[model samples]
Target: MEPGVPDDSENLSDSDIRLETVIQQARLAAGIDGQNYRRRFGSTLETDFGSALLRCEEEGLLEAIPGGAGWRPTSRGFRLNNRIGLLLLEHRSSGPDMDRSNAHGMAES
Candidate 1:
């Protein structure tokens, strides 16, 4: 209902949305390589980058590029990305700058 946030009227579960959102943010911030995710967020993450990508693809939120190792967010995914990014920034700004613990928290279920 808020401006700039994705509509949650779709069938996606809250957990699915959250993981896809985190994946999109990670893709934008640290590149799509799974290694980048593990390095930045640690290897014990509940949802790995590859799994998140697969889930997003399954949910029709991301489309794989033809003959390439990359993917492009679908329109839905794009809106979700923008919405999620804004929410994250807003939350971060509302409090102390996010620390590693908070970053790790995002990866948790």
Candidate 2:
């Protein structure tokens, strides 16, 4: 939980990961159209998911084509997802019972 790095649990939920996977699959398989995206995500195109889409676009993770129905993931998004998976794997291997009080105290100096 570095200052700028969001706590993994806070930034991504199970649903968010599932949605990301679905979006990635759609992009790879047949590409996601607005209708398909909405149906798959169980939400509208103008909600929080919509905001996420926009954020992803801004982050260069995805793109929204003018007059197109759905968005597409950029190369960066694909790479980012892979990196995130690796980080999660590392965190899992380290386990969650790690005590950080000593580390925090040292940092205070």
TM-score of every model? 0.33, 0.43
Model 1 bad stretches (over 4 Å)? 1-48, 82-109
| lDDT, residue 29, candidate 1 | 30
**Candidate number with greatest lDDT:** 2
Cα lDDT tens digits, model 2, 1-109, are 5898767655786555645654555345234465565566654333324444545566676665444455556778666755433433444345442332122121111
Please provide, for model 1 over 8-35, each residue's C-alpha lDDT reduced to its tens digit, 9 standing for 90 to 100: 7578754455445455644453324433
Candidate 2 clashes: the total is 0
Residue clash pairs of candidate 1: none
Cα lDDT of all candidates, in order?
0.46, 0.48
